[model samples]
Structure formats: C-alpha cells, structure tokens
Target: MKTYQEKRHFDKTPEPPWRDDQDKGQHRFVVQKHQAAHLHYDFRLEIGGVLQSWAVPKGPPLKPGVRRLAIKVEDHPVDYIDFAGEIPQGEYGAGSVEIWDKGEFDLKRESTDIVEFSLRGKKLSGSYALIHTADKNWLFIRRKEV
Candidate 1:
C-alpha cells in the first residue's frame, strides 16, 4: 500500500486512494489498456483487499501457446479496478487508462513458478497461465481450449 501511495500524489492524480473496508468478498478482474511511457496492458486480479497487478507489454495474447511478457507491479487499491481516466503528467504512471476487459476469474492452481486461472471476460475467456520467468518477470500464456 505504501508503494502505491508513494508513486502518486493523491492531489495531482485522479486515482483512487487506499481503503480499508473495500473488500466485498467478490473476486473481480480488470485489464486496463494504458498509454504511458509505453503502451501496455495493466492486468489486475482482486485478492485479499487489494488488486494484484501486472504490466503486460504486448497485451494479453488471444491464441493458445502464445506467450507475452508480464511484469509485476505494485498492488493497487481495489477501487482502482474500475478506474479509467488520464493520470496527470509528472505522476508515476502518467497516461490515459481505459478498460479493455473486465469480469471474474476462477483460480485453478497456484505454485511458486506458475498460476493457472480461467478468465471470463468480454474480450478474453478460457484458461490462462502465468509462469514466473525471472524476478518480477512473468510469462502470460493462453492455455489450449479444452
């Protein structure tokens, strides 16, 4: 939470602030297309009380066997899952954000190196896997449809 707050000043940015009573026991997911220093997709999974985030450089692949680089980022507030706007210039992630896809996901498995899940979104659906490739680096792979 500190990392998230430290990156952006609440006064300058429109991003939501950290909330303690935001968790509703509902698992939600969001993929935000961010146009920042570089174009990337921000994938977030609602867990615990925050949103676990990843920055996929090339966006999520739709075809099976295709892998895209996903870099882990700071945990954002749960309220950020629905955020869509322009982050002011000079802010940490100064850019325009738009919701690309959003829905719920089911966790299938989780291990130290990999996490498998099923995403049910308007643009993305079916099983997916995130394999840890290096420290803070992961490979987002679309699993074969079953």
Candidate 2:
C-alpha cells in the first residue's frame, strides 16, 4: 500500500489509515460513489491481501452485454471496504464518498490483467468480467446469462 499511503496524510484525512496487520479479505467487494473532481464509482475487490481498486467513470453496468470504462487505481487498505464519508479538503480524494453497492463475490478467474467474477450484490448479481484493454484501463463488462 505504498502508493495508497503516499497519496494520503493520516493526520488530516478521515480515510482509513493503513495497519499492516490486516487480514486477507474474504472475497468481499465494494462499489463506492465518489463525488470528487468528478462523479465516479470506485469498484474494489479484495484480492491477495489488499483491496485492488478501479475508478469507473460511468459507473458499472447492471444489464448484461454492457461495457463501462474502468481505470485502475491504487490499492486500498482492507479497512477501506466499509469506508464512506467526506475526505477533508486538500486530501488526495477530497470528496463525499458513499457506498453504492456491496456484497460478497466469487472469483472465476484472474491474472495480472483480467479478472472474471460473479457478483452477489444488491444491484449486481451475475457473472462479470474486467478485461484489461490497455495501460490502466479496462473494460468492465456484464456477461450475458447462458
């Protein structure tokens, strides 16, 4: 979380501070609506030990066969899964944050680039794939039911 910590100052912001002893998450995921410089959805998955993050500019798709642009962001702490509040002014992501949808998900496959998963969330409940399109950019696609 070096990149995560470098962008934040724990003393001035309300964002979750990093504690190196955190648990490897239980396949949990979260989508946060962030009203920062722009309105975007922060999609995160608990992978490995940290929360791998992406900033979806147009939000995620609820309908199958739809694609949304997702830009890969820095890793967040495990505790950030439940984080929802305002980041103080001058902070890295200084804006109002709210949980859009959250629930457990099942990973079908993953690699350094692509990740295929099945989400069991309030607004999203089906198979989804995040395919790497290019540097720091990916396609968040809702897979059609078979």
Candidate 3:
C-alpha cells in the first residue's frame, strides 16, 4: 500500500476521487459541514477495489447501543488523506478539508464473509468492523461490549 505522502501528485486534479489509476488502496476520512444540523465526519476505506465509505453523523459514537448512520459515498481515491483545504464555492461538498485521523488497520475476524477490524482515527476512537453485504456494498459498525 502506498503511504499517504506518496499520493501527493494525484491531488492536483479535481476529478472524481477514483479518476486516476494511481488511487489503488487509497482511503480517506472527511469531516464536512452540511447545510443541516450537526457536523458529519466521513470514514472511508479502500477494499475489494473500491472506496468503502460511511457518514457518521455524530462522528462515530463512543458507547455501545449507539448506532450512527454510515451513508456510503462515491468511491474516493486513497490520496484523499492528504486533502485539506477549501473545496471551492458552489461545489457539491463545499467545505474546508482536514486530515483528521489515518493509519493502517488489521482485520481481526470474519465469518460468513463478514470482516472486522480495529479502527484508529482522529475523531473516531475504538475497534470497528466491516461486513460485506453485497458484491460492491458493505456495512461499517463499531464494536461495543455487551
């Protein structure tokens, strides 16, 4: 996997996150200010040849039984980790960008094809899991003790 610093050149273009072929194994966590209540932070991971994304409304709750909505977004390139600046006016996600948290992860378990891993993030702190629902779809949930 390419380190976040190695993908700097791909950031020069404004194309979709998956535009260039150099985006393989890329992941990004984005904190956006929507036109609604509360700020949202997006957690995305590169897996199965696509960018698996989730929108945590409360920035990934820290307790059990607290489920945050993980809305999937367009597949973004792995280089997005280094993206921190204004997204320009009138754009779809027009807001300031910041690299909140990032690092490599390891899959701890998987049964019935569902894979789980320990997550390390800037705003989100805890162990998380990713379950593959379909060929191109997946669900991200944090691990909570019962």
Candidate 4:
C-alpha cells in the first residue's frame, strides 16, 4: 500500500484504516461508486492481504461477454472493503463514496496478464475476467461461465 499511503493524508481523509496485519485467508470484494472529480466505480478485490484495485470508468459490466475498461490503481488496505464515506476536500479522493456492491469472490485463475474470478455480490454474481491490456490498463469482462 505504499502508493496508496503516499497519495493521501489519512488524518484528513476518511479512508479505511491501514493494517498490516489484515487476514489473508478471506476472499472479499467491493465496488464503490465514487463521485470523485470524475464519477467512476472503484473495483477492489482482496488478494494477498491487500485490496487489488481498479478504477472502472463505467463500472463493471453485468452481462456476459461485455467489457469495461479498468485502470489499475494502488493496492488498498483490505479494511477498505467496508469504507463508505466522504473524503474531505483537498484529499486525494475528495468526494463521496458509497458501497455499490459487497460480497465474497472466488478466484479461479490468475496470472500476470489475466485473472479469472467469480463474484457473489448482491448486485454482481457471475464469472469475470480482468485481462491486462497495457500499462495500468485492463479489460474487465463478464464471462459467460466459469
């Protein structure tokens, strides 16, 4: 979370608490509707004790075979999975954030260029894949099946 820490003043923002002792056995995920400078969805999944994050401009696609651009972002603390509040003005993510979806996910396959998973959230429950396209750019696609 080096980049995540360096970008914000935790003292000023209501971001989730940073804990190096976060559990590693949990499989969690969250989609936050962030009304930041630009409206976008922050997609996060718990992996290796941290939240591997992405900024999906239009949110994740729910229909199979559909894709959305997911820009890779800094890894956040796993505690961020439940964070839903306003980030103070002048803060790194100065805006209101609300949990759009929250639930556990099953990671099926993973590699440097692709990650296949299945989400079991209130609003998102299906097989999906995040294909790394280029630097910091990935394609989040809703797969037809596992």
Candidate 5:
C-alpha cells in the first residue's frame, strides 16, 4: 500500500485514492489497456481488500497455446478497478488508460506453480491460467473453452 501511494500523487492524476473498503464478497476483475512507457495490459482481480495486479507486456492472450509475460505489480485500491483516464506526464505510469474488460471471475485453483481462473468479462469470457515462471514473473495463457 505504501509503495502504491508513494508512486502517484492523487491530486495530479485522475487515479483513485486508497480506501479501506473491505468487501470480500466482491469477486470482480478488470483489465486495463495502459499506454505507459510501453503498451501493456493491467490485469486486476479484487481479492482480500485490494486489487492484485499484473502487467502483461504483450497484453493477454486470447487463445490457448499463446502466452504473454505477466509481471506482478503493486496491489491497487478496489476503487481503481473503474479508473480510466490519462495520468500526468511526470507521474508514475503516466499515459492513457482504458478499461479493456470488466466482469466477475472465479478462482478455480491456486498453487505454487500455477493459478487457474475463469473470467466472465465483456470482452473476455473463459478459463485462464497464470504460471509462475520466475520471481515476480508469470505467463498468462488462455485456456481452451470447455
């Protein structure tokens, strides 16, 4: 939480401020197309009280057998799930951001090596897997539809 707050000035950006909304029942998810220093997809899942985030450098793969690099990032406030705007040029992650997909998901499985989930989003609706590749690194892959 400290790292996320330290990286941005809420007053300078349209990003949401940290709030303690402890809604554990909300199993929501969001994918934001972020045009920062590089184009990437910000994948977030509402868990605990924050949004666990990952930055997929090549964006999320839409089909099975394709993989995209996902880098773990700081957890964001739950309110940030709906944020879509441009961050100031000097601020961290400064650039345009838009919601690519927003919906609910079910955590199917979680283990040391892999996480399996099913996302029911506007643009993405299917099972997906995140395989831990290395420290803070993972591979986001779409699973074949059942």
Candidate 6:
C-alpha cells in the first residue's frame, strides 16, 4: 500500500480540494511553522475524512498522561504536503509552512471511543493515541514506552 504522500502526488498538482487533480483521501502529517506565537508546531492527523488539527502548544509530549489541547480545523486537501510558502498576509495560518514530520502510520486500535497509531516523525518519535471524551472532543495522548 502506498503512503498518503506517495498515493497522492502533490508535486504534479498543487491545487486545493474540489479540483480535478485534487485528492480527498485521508492523511496524517505535521507542519512546523514560525507563527505569531513564538514558533510552535502544528500536528494534524486525518480522521473521519477530515484533518484533525492540534496546535501542540508545546509540541508532542514525551511522556504519557500528557494531554494536549487540539483544535480541529477544516479538512485540508491531501496535497497540502506541497505547500511550503507563506500563507500570505490577511490569510488564515499566515506563516511559513514546512514539512516537519510525515509518514505512514498504523492504526493499532481504532473505535468511536479510542484510536491509536504508531507515529513516525522527525520531531516526534513514539506511539500516539487519541481518545474520545464525553464532550465529543478528543484527547491526544502519547502511549507509554514499553
């Protein structure tokens, strides 16, 4: 099976969703940016056909029980990997975008309540999981090292 980046060629086409060359497939990746808030990172993973985004606040936690507040955003095109320029002034996410961490992930366990995956990223090296809460929001947590 091809990875998300490999399945979708962002180089040949750099259009957003709804384009003929666009891909609406699910994907998961991270983007490092020098934003207005002291240069934090953005970790986004695709789920339910939407890109579940999180601002990390301090990047991925190194230990378990570390819950990060993740803010869900609009579903971005799978071709977003090709985006590496400025978001332009007056635009949302107005900052420099760079591929921070990206690769195929294995869904070790998944359900409406919990989802776990082994994340392979340049900045993050460990297994990560997201559990749904009663409020309908999800809690992003790092799995304990075995």
Q: Pick the candidate with the highest lDDT.
A: 2
lDDT of 5 by residue, 1-146 (tens): 88899999988999988876656658899999999999999999887788989999888888777889999999998989999999999999999999999999999987878888999997888899889999999999998875
> Between the candidate structures 1 and 3, which one is better when assessed by lDDT?
1
- lDDT agreement with native, every candidate: 0.92, 0.95, 0.54, 0.93, 0.90, 0.59
Most accurate candidate by TM-score: 2
* TM-score (C-alpha) between model 1 and the true structure: 0.96
Inter-residue clash pairs, candidate 1: none
Give the poorly placed runs of model 4, Cα more than 4 Å off.
Answer: none
Ranking of all candidate structures by their lDDT, best first: 2, 4, 1, 5, 6, 3
lDDT of 4 by residue, 1-146 (tens): 77888898878887876787877879999999999999999999998889999999999899999999999999999889989999998989899999999999999998989998999999999899999999999999999874
What are the per-model C-alpha RMSD values against the true structure?
Answer: 1.0, 0.7, 6.6, 1.0, 1.3, 6.9
| Full ranking by TM-score | 2, 4, 1, 5, 6, 3
Displacement of residue 123 (Cα, Å) in model 1 is 0.3
Deviation from truth (RMSD, Å), model 5: 1.3
Give the lDDT of residue 76 in candidate 3. 53
The Cα error of candidate 3 at residue 68, in Å, is 0.9
Off by over 4 Å in 2: none
Clashing pairs for predicted structure model 6, backbone only? none
Cα-lDDT of candidate 6: 0.59
Q: Which ten residues in a row have the lowest lDDT in candidate 3?
A: 1-10
Which parts of model 6 have CA positions greater than 4 angstroms off? 1-28, 34-39, 47-50, 134-137
State in Å the error of residue 76, model 1. Answer: 0.8
Model 5 scores a TM of 0.93
Between candidates 3 and 6, the one scoring higher on TM-score is 6
In terms of TM-score, how similar is model 4 to the real structure? 0.97
TM-score of 6: 0.67
For model 3, residues 1-146, the per-residue Cα lDDT tens digits are 23222433335534235445655543333443332233577666656455555655656555654655556556555555455665554454655555566665665675754656666565565677656666544556677854
